[model samples]
Structure formats: structure tokens, C-alpha cells
Target chain A: MIRKGMIILVLVTLMAPCVFAQRVHIDIQAQSFKKFKIAMPAYTGQSDLAASLWSSCAKALRVSGVFDVLDPRGYITTAALAEIAPGTLKDWSLIGADYVVTGAASSSAGNVSMTFQVIDLSTSRKILNAQYTTQQGSAYRAVHAFVDALLESSLGIEPLFKTKIVAIREEEGRKQLYVCWPDGTGGQTIRGGGNLVLNPAWSPDGKKIAFVSYWRNNPDLYLLDVASNKVRLISGLQGINSAPSFDQTGNHIACTLSIDGRPELYLIDLATSGRVRLTDSWATDTSPSLCPGGNDLVFCSSRAGSPQIYHMEFSSKKVRRLTFEGGYNTEPACSPKGGLIAFTHLASDRQFHIALIRTDGSSMRVLPGSGRGDESPTFSPDGRLVAFASFDGDLYVSDLMGVAPVKITEGGGFQEPSWSNVMK
Target chain B: MKIGYRGFVVVLVVSVMFLVTGCAKKAVAPPEVEVTPPVVETPKVTTEMDMAEMVDPEVEARRILDQEMAEFENRDISFEFDKFNLTPEARKILAEKASFLNANPGVNILIEGHCDERGTREYNLALGDRRANSAKDYLVFLGIRPDRISTISYGKERPLDPASNEEAWAKNRRANFVILNK
Candidate 1:
């Protein structure tokens, strides 16, 4: 008999790569790692809609990078899938499946119901069971919800299925804002009334976006309310009113403005027209990203004669430099999941790469997937992946270790990608 | 030897006669050119003497004014990479621009700050603002009204040259002038 303290280091989720009882940790950044094999057959009572729902679930599992969804053709056919008997589970074990996900869909009066279960092949037991009913044509919603339930319950990190990413697409000499799912699907173009739209930053609730546009022939900051589809001018100062980011409360925005002379960081109160000057120097300060807490923020500055990332604490007004190794670094993005800052680092190849450092200014490491002009690194809300734009202007999302970056956007002219927080 | 020297003298006399006649024909052609541009047998190459010497004083003044206006707009002030301080060449251009603006008070100008595509987009925007405003401030200090000049920073968006080499980058980092109001 054994008892344990609740230090909660990690949970041994049932997902494993092979037939043996393999312990799976949730960190995809681990150097020595193998994907757990998950078998997802077509949903029973399948229609076109059911097939799509099952496909979305499978795609989410694959995008998570934690599972190797086995080919459906390799699944056993003409066999009894009724019970978790040793004989039946032996067939799955032999097929290299660690777990089998079975689901069913039924349509009623304008509603679709889905029931799914995750069965452990190695232990011969059912691990998760869930039932959901959504509007008939809205079964896609259930797909993400089910995947979220599956992962959040077992792995403690919800897979990125429902999250969205926003980027700037230059079309015919005009730059417009666009939004799509994190998988680079569902591209919806947004014309925010400008010849050039850029620096899109999503609010914490995911309902509001703060961006800068050249609509009035000047770089002015504006807020786009996703629900109303309306834009409100937040700052239209004399010089530049750009690089806006929201505090945690979503009530104020921190941005760079050159109203006086040089570029300096300023915070604007949304409710009131009141303003607070955060930084005052001859040096240029821009691209302020607030920490997960509203108290501290990091930004880019040229105080050292070249652009470098700096950390600023609001309470003490104490500022420290975050990057020292690189002569050029800018566009610091504070991780929403906490304690990490991602920015663009110019490497020896003279190409820009995404580098991550702890908020304490330690353990700075450059990521892989370095392209010629990789910039604007935004952390996924789950904090596991970062989506950045490359020299070709396509957005790519890679994990923290920067392995196997999936090209999320295509055909260039798409860049300055800002990953939205997971939709409510 | 006598025959060769005599032949040389004859050739020189014939060439001098042709040159004199040609000079007389060209000298007589200016009035006709004032009426309509004369079609010379050779390709037209206009030197400063062509405009200043042949044209009347009023027309010459208009031409000079036009040249100054074009120079005001065409002569862009460039900056060092990642720095916004005005170079001596930039200051010289701004001084000349001030002289032009003062002479033509009815004209207003817009200064557009641009940068090379080397740094992050947002930082470049800030750098561009500094470049544009620095040019504007210098012009203002040179006795130009602040309201007469408006500045905008295109950041790395509008490049005078889009190539990604040293030459293109040097051309791109500039503060360009546009005559906004005439």
C-alpha cells in the first residue's frame, strides 16, 4: 500500500506510443519524446456531418502533437468492438494502438447528440466518457469541446482547436486584417478602414482587438470589437500612435506615441481620456507587451544604442534589459500562460529567429525553424506553441522546441500574426 | 614632300570652311527654336547654355522656379541605418527646402519618414517617426512655420527601393518631401 503528497509534478495520462504501459508527460518540449498512438475510427450512425465532426476531433488530436492518430484502415474490421476483453484488446495492442476513441452521433429535432469514449487498450478499461448535444448544423462546436474535455481532463492542457489567429494580409498595395483558426483555416478578411493595417493585438477576452492603421494618413491605434464589428479610434496622436497592447484588465492600453518628440511608452485609459506616461527618454521605446499580470510589461528600446528587449515594472517604475547576447532583438511578446517572453532575435546568419526567455531574464534560447525574416512571435494561449511570420510573409506555428513548424498561412503577404486567446 | 604638305593645307582649308558654315547655321537657329523646337540633324542634347542663353528673362525665371520646385521635391534626405539623427547632408537639404518654402509661402509640404526592412516592423515605425520629425524640426528651426509642414512615418511599408541589399537599404532609409499644397 502507498500514499503520496499532492505536489502534482505530472499526471501519467493513458496516452502511450506502443502496447506497453508507457507513462506520458504533457510537455511537448521534452527532447526525448514519442507520440501516443490514438485510434479514432469513423463515428457510428455516420452521416456527412458525423464524418466531419469525427474528422475535426482527429485533426485536433494531431495538431496537439501529443498523439499519433493511427490510420483508420489499419483499425480492425469485422470484429467484436463491444467489450474490453483481453482477446479483443489484443487485436488493438498488436496494431500498435495505445488507446481507441469511439464516438456516435444521432440527429433529433434540430439537434445533434454526440457520445464519445476513450478506451485504454493496455489496461483494458474505459478512461473517459462524454455526451454532448449541440444545434444540428453546429456539431463543429462539439468537436472542439470534446477534444478540450479529453485533453484538459487527462493531460491538463487543452489542445488548440477553437483558438483563432489574426494577421495582416497585403492586397493590391493595401494591408488588411484577417482572422482564421489556429490551423490556418477559415480565413475571414477584415478591412479596418486603412491603406495599411498592422500590429494586431487581441484583448484578453478574445472579443476585442487592438491594432494600428493608416486610415487617416497617420499611424493611429484603434480597437476592433469582434462582436459588433465596429472600430473605435483609441489614439490619434500627432506622430505615431502604434504598437498597442491591452493590460490584463482590458481597461487600458499601452502603446508608443511620439506626440512630444521621441517615441515613448504611454498608457491610455479606455473609459476616460486620461493618460499616463510610462517611459521618458531620448531613446525610442516601442512594442510594449504586458505581462500576464497587469503590473509588469516588456518592450523594445534603443537605450543601449541598438534595439533590445526591456522589462518594466509598473510599481517601482524599475526597468531592466531582458536580452543581452543578441545585438538586435525586438517585438517582445509576453506569454499569456505566464513567465515567458518571446521576441525576434537576429542571428549570425543575418536572419531573424524567434527566441524565448523567462520573464526573469534568464535561460535565453533561440528557437529552431529560423527563417530569413521570422518576426512578431505571439504565444498560443495554451502556451505550448508560438505562431510567427517569416520572410515570405506566411505565418507558421511551432512548439516551444521549434520542431516541425507547420506552415499555417500561404501565398505570402500574410504576416504580423497575433494568436487570439482560446475562444470562450 | 611639297605635294603632301599642299594636300594637307587644302584639307584644312576645306574643313575650316565647313566648320564656319555650320557655326553660322546653328547661330541663326535660336529664334526659330523659340517659335518651335528646331529639328537638328543630330540628337538634341540641351546644356544650361541652351535654356539660359536663348530664352527671355521671364521664361528663364519660370524655368529656374520650376527647377527649384523639382529639386525641393526630388532631393530626399537620407539617414544612417537604425539612427535618426540628421546628417550634414540632410541638414543642407533641409536648409535649401526652407529657402524654397520661404520664397513660395503658398506651398505646404509633407515629410514622409521611411526605413529599411531590417528591424522589427513596430520599431521601424518609431524610427521612422523620429526621422520624419527630426527633419520637420530642423526645417522649423530654420524659420519655417510648424503648421506648414506635416510629417508621417510609413515605417518599413513604403520603400523607395524594394531590394534587400546595401544599396537598396540606403536608398530606402530616407525622409522624402512632397508638395502637399500649391
Candidate 2:
């Protein structure tokens, strides 16, 4: 992560004309500024694949919340639609673009090649360029790779491209476990789903999903191996065994169990099946989310009279209240980056909204464009975007840029969406 | 005797299914006589006289147990929204359940605590836990063995009403009883 006040200057230069025909190459520096406006025109290519890749790239840039992506309709022109050139730099800058990225895609059969360049409008010189050869219709993978590399190298941040979210889609009492990309593509229902699956939490390795199911007529925590459809019951104690969270090691889970006659937080070791009690409150303690570091857990508790988020440290067993403004704040999801915690807050309007606060319980605010009845806020693997179930029961992903949360999923009744780690 | 009766029922159902399929196939294609080969399996089924001889007291015992268990399950105790404490009416219901449980020895029950859709899924699960176990505690106090009763909270995932209205929500927040065999 970049320091809040630091600055980075990104530099890019073009390769020779012949080499640029098939592939673009240039140098790059780090970038620290926010909201750098960039104009991207349709890449020069004849295939429909090129058009699809362009739209995918444009949406990715906008969703990153790092760039003010200029509206393509504003940049549409007779010549701009046909081809991209260095001569178009003036047109992009005239539209108040501080930077411009242009590309060309050509594909036949199984192979597709994409050549792209990023230019700094102030210098009127190309600052970065690259090329990729990939399977047709998956040129977006190259774009994702580029964005991942660009963010890591330039901003010290992880990109959220091509990530998958697993959520339970329920209709007419049949709940099927659904997994899809952030853009609603490549969706497939995971096997071994039951009629009552809730609260999916991804393992750090992205290879497993821990969720609650009632296959045995009890709400027990179950771990599902993504590669194989095999499932193993992680916890089946009496009463409720829900809200499973994998610690950083993936060998332990922090969950809620009521075996002691009331709901309390418990840590179950995956290896020994041993358990450790974490909370001793008389009130119900649930929705435990392990921080990225695994030392702290943010969970919703009724210890303070109503549902509120609490932060607990394992070493000292110290507990502190996190949310005081809302009487119905719950379902806390600690970010992967370990700085912020996202949770559902019942606003004064009686609508549940997704809100974020620092780990210390400061700077609490509802996320912009958060819908009513929003619950189960899960962060992207990179901590850049948040995927949550909206009021209408569709999965929505937003970058917190004040843009309305885009519905990345179509099916209704998506509940407790758990985002997998960036696809390995 | 139970095994023989169940076997007879299975064979009877399978033969009926075969007859139905055979007739459908004949209607679809009269020339395909090979499709009606179920005639060979028809003789394997036992006559009604063999079934009449297999009847035993165990079958009547099971029927009575099932009816009594259904009544036990149908006697669901309700709670106020977001609250799990037993009320006067709920306590009266539980007192009657305690007698039934005392009379039926060797029978175990599972108490499922549920919530309405008005609350979030995870928190309601915890609430449901308290709701179900609260009933279990009272039963244990009323002289029922703790080992005879188990509890599970379905939270808001399983709803009795499945509606967004208050009446449905009221019907949903209750502790339901399920019979389990030893």
C-alpha cells in the first residue's frame, strides 16, 4: 500500500515502429495520485473480440476507482472509432484527459494478440506499452494482468480483476451455492450445495470455501474443497454453528458455536478438532471475521444491548466496542489489507446499509451508493472493491468511488457473498 | 416381519411401475413386444396372503409413535420478534410437552430455533440458538434429560411463513421440535 501523502511519477515510452506492430514495450514508474483521468478509445481491430475486450478494459478502469475514466460516448468520433494513433493525443487532451491508453486487437482461431500503450498527455509522449497473445475472448485476462502489474508496480496495490465471488442464490426454498466472476461472467454453481447454505467465507488460498449448511438438519460449518466437490464438516456442535471465518493460516477457523448453551465465539482448529472459547458474554456473539493478520477478530455482538461490532485481540483477550452510532450494526468483514472493517449498519431509515470503519472504530461512514437492505460486506481479495448483496438480492460490486454499485450478478436472493482470493 | 412387509411393498410398487411403463411403451409402439418383458418379473411378487401373515404388533407400535410424534412436532412454541424469552403461553405449551416427553421414554428430540427474514442471517442464527436452547433449558428444568434433547438454530434461512408480512414473521419466530430415534 502506498503512503497517504507520497507521490509517484509514472513514465512510459514507445518501442520501435516495427516492434510496436505486434507488441508494445516501454518503461514504467510508480504512481501515487488519485483520480487521474484517462481516455481509452476503441482499439483498432476488425474482430468482435476486440470490441468485447475494449468494453471489459473500460469497465475495469472505471471500477478501480483510481482513474476518472472519461465517458467513451464523449470520445466517440468517426476516425477515433476506426483507428488509434499518436495524432489522437490532442483530441484526448482536449476532452480534459490527463492520460490516454490506446490499443489494437487482432484475433483468428484460438489465438489473439493485443498491443496497447499508455501515454502522459502533459508530456505528449507514450509512457508505457505492452502486448499479449492469448485465447480469443480472454484478452481481458491480459488486461487484468496488465492492471495487476500496473497497480502493484506503480501504486503498491493489488488489482481486483478477474476475481470470483461465491454466494448463495435462493429461490422458492432451494438454495444453490453460486460462484461467478465480479462481472457476472463465468458463473457456475458449486456442487454439494444444500437447500439451506449461508455465510460463505473464502480461505486465503482461494482453494476452499467454508460455509454453513443444514444437510444434517443442523446449521453446521462445512469446508468445501473447490478443486474437488468433497465437503467436510468443520463444526457440528449443538445449537448454531454458523459464520465461519478462516484464519490467515487456513488451519484454524473462528466461528460461532452455542454448545455451551448460548451463542459465543469459538476458534476451532482444523487439524485436531480442538476448540478455544474466545468470548464469555451472556449475550449472543456472532459474525466473527478474522483480520488479515489473524491476531484480531471483528465480530457482531449483542453484549452492548443491541447488535454492534466489536474488535478482539487474541493474545491479550482484550475486547473493545467498535460501532456506537447504530443499534443494528452486524456482519463485520475485515478487509484483506487489515486497515478497514466493513459491516452492515441499520440506518435511521430502517434500511440496512454497508458501512466501513477503521480497525480502531474511527471514521465510520456508510459506503457511497450502498443500497437499502445491504448485508454481508465482503472485500475483494485486494481490498480495492467490496462485493455485497443488494436490497433486491443481486450481488453488487463497487470501488467506493460514489458510482452506483454495479450489479455484477443477475440471480436474486444472493446472500452472504464471500469473495475468493484473486484467482491463483 | 417389518422387513418382509417393506420388501413386499417395494416389489408391489416396482411391478406397478413396470406395468405402467409397459402399457405406455405398447401404446407408443405395438410392434415392440420385447419392451413388455416385465411379465417375467410379475411372478416374483408375493401374493396378498403373504403380506397379511407378516403383520405384527411392532407395525402398530410404529404407527402410534408416528402419530404421537406428529402431534409433538405440530405443537410449535412461538416467541416475540427478536426476543427468545419464554412467555406465559409458551411456558404452558412447554409444560404439556414435558409430560409427553416424560411418558415417551427412549425418545429424543431436536429443537430447531428459527427467526424471521426481518433480521440478518448470521445474527439471527445466534438469536435462534438462544431461542431453541432456552426451550431445552426449561425442559431440562422440568425433569427431562439433557441428553434426550438437542438444539440447532436455522436462523432466518428456513422460515415457516416465507412471507414478508407481520403475520408470517410472527409465525416464523418459533422453536420447532423434531423427533429423532435413539
Top candidate when judged by lDDT against the true structure: 1
State chain A's TM-score for model 1: 0.81
Q: Model 1, range A387-412, lDDT digits (tens) per residue?
A: 99987788888778776677766788
User: What fraction of the reference structure's interface contacts does model 1 contain?
Assistant: 0.93
- For candidate 2, write residues A1-424 as lDDT tens digits: 1111111111222123221121222221112334668887777887477678877777666666566678878884524343346676688889988867777877777767777777678777665566666665455666665555445433455556546778888777677677766666555666455777888888888778898888887888898877666789998876778889998889999999888889899999999999999999989899999998778899999887899999999999999999999789999999887888989888877788888888999988787555557878888877767888876688888764435677776657777788878655
Docking class of 2: medium
Q: After superposing candidate 2, which stretches have Cα over 4 Å from the reference?
A: A1-34, A76-83, A137-139, A149-156, A171-173, A401-403, A422-424, B1-69
lDDT of 1 at B180: 84
Q: How does residue B139 of candidate 2 score in lDDT?
A: 95
B15 in model 2: Cα distance from truth in Å? 68
Instruction: Give residue A259's lDDT in candidate 2 (0 to 100).
Output: 80
Task: Please give the TM-score of chain B in predicted model 2.
Answer: 0.66
